[model samples]
Target chain A: MSRLNEAEIRRIAELAVKQLEGQATAANVEKVVHEAVQRMSGEGAATAARHERMKNVPPHNQAKGQRIILTAFGANSIGILAGLTSELAALKCDIVDLSQKIMQDFFTIMILVDAGNSDVAYEQIRERMARVGESFNLKVIVQHEDIFKTMHRV
Target chain B: MRIELPEILETIRMTEVEHFDIRTVTMGINLKDCISDSLPRLKNNIYEKLMRTAAEHVATAEKVEAQYGISIANKRISVTPVALVGDGYYAEDFVEIAEVLDKAADNLGVDYLGGFSALVQKGFSKGDLSLIRAIPEALTSTRHVCASVNVATTKAGINMDAVYLMGKIIKQTAEKSADNDGIGCAKLVVFANAPEDNPFIAGAFHGVSEPDVVVNVGISGPGVILRAVKEARNADFPTLADHIRRMAFKITRAGEFVGRKVAELQNIPYGIVDISLAPTPMPGDSIADILKAMGLQDVGAPGTTAALALLNDAVKRGGLMASSHVGGMSGAFIPVSEDQGMISAARAGHITLEKMEAMTSVCSVGIDMVAVPGDTSAESIAGLIADECAIGVSNSKTTAVRVIPVPGKTVGEEADYGGLLGIAPIMPLSKIDNSHFIHRGGRIPAPVKGINN
Candidate 1:
């Protein structure tokens, strides 16, 4: 069986939603979309393809451009992002993406960084970030992107 | 697909604020082929094989930890039960073998090497007897070698003779390491129906059925569960259980990922992920704290056992869904000394040894890391093991005892065994003597549960 591409999956999902519009409840729409995706993906073929792709990516290349997800939560303070991003810059880590917000007087920030070219080790980067966060009374944590992907994604 | 930012942040929060981390990635190296009738050759063979198999164990685990930013708390090795491998060896010969294990573990730079163990659930073989006798000296002499003896199983019944012998061994081990606060006893455990693939010490051992070498992972995160329960404080029972189940699912998935990665890197088969909420001496990382979060005033409060039963069941239900292969004592551990909340509860007289036994009936392992008075009789200790074994055998669960009789320490006094073993307030034991019962050197017949086959 051929593997389903991203576009094919999206098309199937959209079609399933449209076909179930009036007759199906929200959960039924979800079930229809899920079944459509499952049918289109040809059972285990998509997973096999993913494994094949993962094998071709060399470890050196994988390590050269590592992804890190950093989160800081605690007291809401001004210039917190400036302080954090500047520390990443000093460590030679590039911020690929970022989001920050304050809820109920608690500040929360999430930053995705490419630390491939960083001069320091990942542990050192985490330590520095934690130290900077502590100065602002925040709890900082740095974790690799794979953890989130493996945990949240199938 | 891009992962949700909230999920990513929650994972980060768990590890950063809560103590979510991979507790152990133990390499199980089978030493069956290293057996020899000559003691010296046996030791040499075992050492060479362990060095070759586990040389990269610690380094590989550390490398994976660095790559994933997950803390692998301990790197350890569990070899084939030494009693089986040292078939005809005597007590002294077993001690020599233990020294070799200690040397290999030191060379590999791992913290602990388990499986200086004997499985005598039914009856003692020559090797089992020799190993049991050698346990006290072996544990006292070796720096990182841990020992366990299985004295009961559902099918085989409880070996009262082995239980009584282990009681004496425990006393001797405590006295042998008296200067170190009976720390040797901390490295030993007696089990009923012990899991072969358990990655946690002091009870990890490679079973005969296991492959030549395997990598088993033990993932722990009591603090993370505590935080989740705290957040769901006002929720109903179903919501609370669902929250714990989801958290356990995530934790086990993380463990499975790490275990597979480490196994692949080391060129060994991935064993099982022990999804136990193993507590540490750290304050927030206490399983008892999770119980308190479930609305219990303190850990040993009246509703604590029921609360623990719910937590344990939820953890297993969630973890079983996440991992394809889940084994070991995969539930909540209520070790007294290892958990700060349990320690304080014992000191405050809110928890006692009897209550601990009751709690264990619903949890993973029983009567673990409990410290008793110096004068606690060996017979009484054996009686404690018998009771715990009865619980395990009747219910077809795994129960273990790692009680330490701290030499020269009385009730209300504390004995400190630093590092992960932690400290414990010596609890008083029953005054009633059980020497007659323990001295009745025979097996207790298997219960009705064991007759299923």
Candidate 2:
């Protein structure tokens, strides 16, 4: 019964811009925002309940910057990147940055993924990524990037 | 905003390769309010409080460990010294209280519960007398309960009466648990100037001044520092100190991060990050190895104390810079049975009991996890503890004795405690009698205030 607040509207607008990938027209922005509002309102009670649940979680414990860092270690092989990317795409996780190195027969790939817009939980994302790692016979480490920042930064 | 690839990889390498882990996340609970006139009510109150407060400790630690990819070696609990809570209880009642604590620790899934303790540095109350009497039986009856008694302080001098009593108690504990290599003695620590917020077991206790409940962390990374020391082999002392400081800073930061996160999740105040480089029995993770890497021929060489002083000082200096809240005995721990290198040194007869005693002067704690001969007399044990207490009193620092007299085990034999408690080589002890000196059991007056070099 309550209308969206300014911050919520701003969050929606920002998510829409990220989805549009710089091809934002006024009409397109309006249409995306309209769709999102309708979808959210359709799940009004559930969304409000989730928000209430989230209020108890301290901000720092949440995904820092709404992102996670995934590091994979395994033997050099084909379809590793394709398989991982497809799974991430299916989960609506955006690959913000990625780098890979192959030393002799072994390979180490580090990917920074943004899961802000994904509907899934952080634990679910980590579990799903673990499954993908298992499928590729890789040892995948999915950690909230906040830990690295806490240790390596200050 | 971006962390480089090398930095990320280095963090991973520290945990995955170097055996870097949070030594323990110890929750300290105050039991003063759980006291009651009825023994049964007191026992029930203590059990219910511990169960309710620490209900989520293990689960929270697991979640944090999984999230951060860093391992928490042990989850533990420390309570307000039971002697303070059970003031009117008898020794038998105290033993029953120890049983409740043991059961609570087991049900909570914590490895150990400390603070079955008494502070009689100056003198003992009636309750302290009861708790002291109960120690051996309490330890023998329980698996997870640990006990400590503070018998000296810089200001209070040494309570030789308490010192002599603890020696007898240690002997009784060893004899009662004789089948398990006198393991009960391993769980009892006698201290001079014990730290209130220490997170390590067999010594940790929630001090009188502490808040009702708080979470404190102990950091471990001997392997990480050993690697750094190896890499800086050619550097001079100052440069070497810097390398150690930087490494200590990183590990302490990691510890503080984990501690704060755990406390946040538990909704309790985060007490401290004890930056002690506690070593384990695992290969390459040892304070002795770090000393050897620091140019010592072996741990017991002539310069062993100097090497330990340097390592201990550098750890404290670096750790102080890394965390805002630091407390406990934040110095390099050299538990003989717990550190593999120390065990090797003992087995080789390279590190003698005398050398280890001298080293405790400059280290965080006194001679720890030492297993002497079965026939070692109680007076000799009292003499040894008094010696360490003298060092602590003179230097205004903390010291302790966790010596075990393995029944039927002597020099050239080893007490195999397995897993974390590790193996202890029965080191030789001097046979010269100190009965006359120890039997004069009055208090040693407090040392002169500062200025008497």
Candidate 3:
């Protein structure tokens, strides 16, 4: 679902209250507000609840494991993604996000994967990626997403 | 908290490409309870206690490293000062205990075992004198044992007698290990106002006030800090300082996490996290490089000390905000031999011994890992220690001297102390003799500024 901005939420709440006017009992107002929010959020309330539950459970036990950010840097070469993704797939890591670019003979790739459901441990997955990168003379680094959030964000 | 994609990539680059890692996880063990008048029983008790306390140290540190995907470089052990524990023992007896400590460290797969120390900041007890006398032999005979002596404090004046004694002892140690280019002296340190829970080698010792067992972690990442500074080249001073402070906070937070995890695994209390920007001999991991990246053409050039002052203060400010129990010498370490940039600067004659001493006044520890000529008088060495002690006592900061006098090596030569100790060029010393001043030694009275009461 797309993000709901503060302005949109406020506008929807105001509209709901205005529509109920004199008949706006507390329960009637609450129902109108909930329905407006659900419609504006582009998902049913039940689907939002399911998403919250998914977040509460440990990432490894979920269908998609914890998020890992893998970065590779080296000379521009073909078939790099083919090599890396095959190894990751064997380890049960699901690709959640990926970006690759080549500039002036330099190649760089960044992949965010969910390794929570992977049978391999974090260390093992890192080692496996390192081996694959080394075969193509590239440098691969894997780190947990939490480290970045803790360091970069408040 | 949701982690952004760019932040994750930045962390990966820092750890994998920039060589960011925890420097050490040192376990401090109190051996006061291991004291015994009988030499053999005392040795046995000390060994058994070390074995029991530090048995899981290496394995646990390794496990944690694998779990976190970060490297924990060294696992070491520090115990209560031997002078206090080996009371009434002869100098030779202290040597035996040093051997036992070395054996225990070997058994536990630890790289260094500190606390063969004497605290004679005021005056020498019989035990302190004995341990001082045994230092040269203790350091040369054992491979992993580290020795330190505290000779001055703000409350108590400098002990001139101990200073003189350490000078002679240092010379003896260098002579005893001449074949190794005075490597024994690399393992010894002389401190003024030394911290009790320092996790760095050559000065680490469990203070008399510390608990039975505690885990202290030393986190280091000169490369990481350098990268941050380089990225903010065009920014103003406040912005640059904020960048460094933020980086330091993250580094210290990681250190605290590792320290707490290791402490929990060992079932011991978590001790302080020493957020010293310790540098190795690696190409990109020098503290001097950080200063150079800050726009100094060379490390010892003008404004170098000012840059170091800013870096050191910013690190402490950042680290203090990151960890509740920050202690030890929590600033950037400027050991010459152990830093590649420093080695290059010294070799190019851009930096000098006096400049290093001046830098230490602002940095964490005093002149460290410096190599002087063999013919340099013992009196001069004592005078150097006295000068450094004066700085620590006056400023109420922790200062230490770990200069190695490479016997038969003169200026323009190099002494290769392999591995983490690195290599040093034999820097020239003053030709002026301070023998009369050193020989007429008496306590330099504590400064009036120390009387804040």
Candidate 4:
């Protein structure tokens, strides 16, 4: 999972507010976005190869926006195709890859992030993110970067 | 390979959860009568018995496993009680017998060997006393050979004498093979009213009623069960029960298939299938994770009993439905020392022996993976063993204890059994001795007096 900067989290909040408006269920959209953004911390995968690759990329690279598609199901239905670029806007977090899948009752969001360490309080953020999921009636679980790597390696 | 989720569910209909696997195929043989005053003759007799019975055990196990597509996780052997066999023997004689047992297991392709045991809860027999004395040497001198000494029971109090001996023996065994990674102690176990027909090794023994050459199995699948649980954590309690019941059914079916096949391959009659959920050192420790998933921070919480009861009951139901014959300690293992997760919880002070015993009430086995102070008296040890056995006998289920007493360690210290059985921090036991009660030797009559089951 990629780490996002405060500005990137703020930008995500602004976009989510703009795109969803009422579609965003929570009264505090920024809190939800920040929480979601914080989840994109260190990329924990099966191997350290990606971390090595992320290290080589210029920290100043700003134009490289990545796309992420997130879907929320279960509690709600939602689909988001997000466009993000150079991690500088994301506090050195480069969105290398992202995917989302939802069935009738379960929602999963997978992301690959190349950013600074994103470890932060997740519970309060999780509450904010819950509103985004509530609007769609989806139970969304965002997995970090390297988790999918080791998860699939098994 | 991806099909519509609903379509897949509809197509399969998830029919009655036919997920079956083999638990274990234990070859139990009587070795007590094999003991002789003459050391060489005793060794020879043991070799003849085990070699003759278990010669084809491995090949047969493989053939059966392949034929059934069910994983037979453990291939093991249990013998007559060591005390019964080594009656009136010296320490050297006991060591000699242990070596023969070890050689027999190795040659037979058995991964784990059991039945280095002494049942002296009520009182020590002539042989029981000798066997108890010989345990430290027997365990230290041999590999793959396991040991157990019962010191107490409900009917009788505790055997402080035996308890003291055991404390010293555990230390000696650990120190003697400290270089072999102290792997010798892992092979041994202690118990109260130890079952003779247990298919699980390091404790299995051939009961007097057992057929001369039958094969039993101890099926283990905590990993498989854990996966099922993780998949259904969000479901409600009843739904979870349904999921668990289905999972258990599949596991038992697999066990029965493997056990039958192994018996066929070995040309012996297929015995019972023990559908026990045994944990390994893997990430998904069935016992620990199951507890965690049940909403407890760890396994020692108050909810532990209810959760364990459900697990044990579901396993038995599923196993009984799958196989006509089911025996052994077929329940969840609470071996604190053996499970890495348990070690973590214990280290964090989230678990205790009392809570462990509480969970044992619901689960099949009793207080496992416990390490005690080296100075604990034999009588006190006997008392503890008796209390555990009383629970088993009164409840009409099997219960046993396998405690390790690390010499020179006080409560809150660590004794590293290492590799598989794992390490145990010395657990505190009440310093009070119950030797006065243990000194009174009288058999607690079997619960079999009832007319109907």
Candidate 5:
């Protein structure tokens, strides 16, 4: 793009100050004019340029969580509108398949994990699950894939 | 140690163990060939079949449980509807055969033997006729044998004659077993759409299509589900729904795991998982406890129906989301003798048979563990079973009755079956009788105009 010369920048600054004259007092207009010149000449707004450049970065840097299947009581308790996949993303857990049903209560969730950088422990996962149950008034349980399918009929 | 309160500690003990258990190991042996003209030969064949089936069943079931470190609450068997097998055999001969079965179960170390049943949904076969006729004597004569009659089922309307006969037979059966806590009646169940693969008794039957043998899992957890629901009640509706869904998923998963393992160890095909909230006669093991925790004084309180409906819906919803194959009566149970809260409610005059029947509309089975007065006619028992079956047929759902008539035990007297068949204090029934109509001996026609197709 063609750059504005010093003379043009000066005229632009003058016009900007003239338009703001009725809305501001003399000292305010002079302060505004001084700030306008810095922006127009690219002396400020470096972060805005950097943001625009980073907008074109690769997709790998913006990946999200995965989804899996959870099985439990009465009937399919998975919500139709959201589906488990979306909920898994919301909760940052990867889900796989519906596994088993137990004594008219308790659901088993099966998930695939990267476990790359999670700070949470397996016990913590169970505690968070207990909290989930308390919050939703449900009995949510998690099991590894082997244990789930081992007890399940094909 | 800061010890917990006594009652609470007792509740925990009951949840863990208190001699309440898998009451019987019933091996359902098919008796198709035990129909000889000579009563002696028929009896011998029946004994041989039951002995063969029960022995292997006990050994295999015990071995499987030991191998997997999982509990097989009851190691029982069910056979084809008895009437089908005893075709052309005299009713007297059938009684001899039933006696043989009792002996076989005793000899085989099995507690109870089920499948002395007849399926007369559409029309009674000649054998069905004889078996139904001999029910009272057959049950009364045996110590370990159990019998059930399917008089009505979906697609088949009620049979008034069978209904009436069942009532009379139940009375007779009660009279015969009077000294034994009317134990004969304890072994009977009137069913509609009975599953052929249920692992539980006194109504389980092995269907025709089943492999010569197969394994079914009956996992129970009134306590587990109640614990989950009680923990979640403080949350909002949506949150509570999610919590129930998650917990149900886990419990069912556990059952599914154990069921498959049992099936594999038995070397049989795995049957569908039945997520019925089977309650125990133990304190914390009651579904009514869960309801009370949900804020009810007793099971039949005003909001009880709503609570049951919510529980049924929530349970099914959660179970379906978790398992692919769901079958049998997959709802909560309310059997009086089988559940402590129910027994207490009946004893305290807080619950009645009518209310229990009403609740069956939302339960896994209808009118289970109900004990009536010994003097009551078989017609009334038939009427009770019929009414319960009618609800199931009309709704196209599974319903059943395991009504016990404790012979010498009065309305307030107790009948103890030891172990899972806990002590049962009788409940009062309406005096309105139906002997005449039930005795009419013809069929109650299938719903004519109700069919849309």
Candidate 6:
């Protein structure tokens, strides 16, 4: 959440204008500026650093960036994962980590999703996931993982 | 996952099953600058200030609730004590101010607005006297306005005159709202050593020293701790305390997260989190139930005070570590009507007024939500408040009285407030005359502890 300095912002704007000189339409200028800002804001760098720091951790536990934990539980049935994953994919969300367990007649699945890349709002994704759960006759809930980190971690 | 399955499931159980939720998100808006000699200009200033600052308070709270999957029970506002903002006004003018606050609260979509208050712990200002006289009328006329008067503190001792005046005020308020079982009294609190940044209603106020605007939160989770204590049934005292502390720590973290998110969204400064284990009328969500889980046969049993002392201490110790900015009444609240176990014990003749008084010495608040017969003399109510003030001043703790003298109700009947105010069975009080003592009202000198500095 660090803010860029004035000098840094001017540098990014200058680079964007110089790169888009030949094809400087409004849309193209906007696209280049957006990408440049995203790259300079540490979204790309922070993700790389986070992955480097989490190299020793298991893939299932290395949830970083803007991620959410989606939990689904109900009677054991087919296609729950398929239905949920398809909806997440259509929404442009990445399934960073997932685990499932079945006990007797009931199944519970927890999925760690990297939602940073999604163009859809988190609220809409939650609504879509809920619809997916309703279609599969399961109870699904999505919550930002920060709550767990705050409670369980130091 | 970095957070194991057990951790995730435990959180879900606490929120979905055990009723762990942020009890309130209160925005404290300082209204000192709105003061004026002209009442209309004053009213306009107060309304515009509150509406402009807190326009999105409820919506921001709801958005955070949705984001975290933990529901916030109440969205409220606490302004500077009205008496301070409208100092030169008379009683009727203060009542008009209350109406404006109520309108602002309704328009903002908040459930309650506090700080219809006066601080008279040492002595009354002209405004304080006026507001005290206006309480019964102001509370009866408004739906969302809550009032409090601080009559005592450790430093200044008990203002016996203010305490006696409050007793009469409580009676008048009861008479005014008699048809609703003296429900107006439920919205009024008399305090000793009241906190300035308290987010809980009926006693919350934006203290004079506070910033222009800030946000405070109250955390409530009796059910979560009750479950933890129940699971550790056979464990000894230290282990029991440990279990309570861990549960308190987790809930405090959640509470702070919610508070900070709401403040962040509104772009306001975040204040303290009052980590009080405030219970609702829900059956399992009772502090008395937690005591029973800690091996008490029932509330008001012989060791009840000891159990409560331990529970309150552990909650404070645990919560203090979880949040750096812990303030307000951060202990186990044992309000009778709002907690079902407390109501049950009172109805069974197990928990009495005397025992509750003793418990408040070791807890956060005092004499909260207890109902009495309509005929209880003002002197008797004053005596009860004086006793609580004595405990608070002597022990250096925050204490309060929210006693309801339910009009036309007797010991065998109950007064129903219906919502979070809950219901209260009429508890018997001593019939002995205390008029001679109460009428000698001037001041009880500050206790020895008050001179510690």
Q: Lowest-lDDT window of 10 residues in candidate 3 chain A?
A: A58-67
Task: For model 1, state the Cα shift of residue B283 in Å.
Answer: 1.2
Q: Write the number of the candidate with greater lDDT, choosing between 1 and 5.
A: 1
Q: Which number leads on DockQ? A: 6
When superposed on Cα atoms, how far off is each prediction in RMSD?
A: 13.1, 8.8, 11.6, 23.1, 21.7, 5.8
**What is the per-residue lDDT of model 6 for residues B1-453, given as tens digits with 9 covering 90 to 100?**
377887888988998899999999999999998988788899999999989999999999998888778889999999999888888789999999999999999999999999999999999899999999999999999999999999999999999999999999999999999999999999999999999999998999999989999999999999999998988879999999999999999999999999999999889999999988999999889999999988888999999999999999989888998999999888789999999999999999999999999999999889999999999999999999999999999989899999999999989999988989998999999999989999997999999889996
For all predictions in the order shown, the interface RMSD in Å is 2.0, 1.1, 2.5, 14.8, 14.4, 1.4
Give the lDDT of residue A64 in candidate 4. Answer: 34
Please name the candidate that would achieve the greatest TM-score relative to the true structure: 6
Q: List, residue by residue over A1-154, the lDDT tens digit for candidate 3.
A: 2567778878787988788988988899889987888677665466689988998785545754278878888997888999999999999888877888787988888887888778898878989999999998999878666555556654
TM-score of chain B of each: 0.99, 0.99, 0.99, 0.84, 0.87, 0.99
Question: Candidate 2 vs candidate 4: which has greater TM-score?
Answer: 2
* Between candidates 2 and 3, the lDDT winner: 2
Task: Report the TM-score of candidate 2, chain B only.
Answer: 0.99
CA deviation > 4 Å runs, candidate 2: A2-65, B450-453
Give the TM-score of chain A, superposed on the true chain A, for all candidates in the order listed: 0.58, 0.59, 0.59, 0.32, 0.32, 0.60
In order, what lDDT does every prediction score? 0.90, 0.92, 0.89, 0.63, 0.65, 0.92
The candidate, 2 or 6, that scores higher on DockQ is 6
Model 5 chain B worst lDDT window (10 residues): B1-10
The DockQ ranking, best first, is: 6, 2, 1, 3, 5, 4
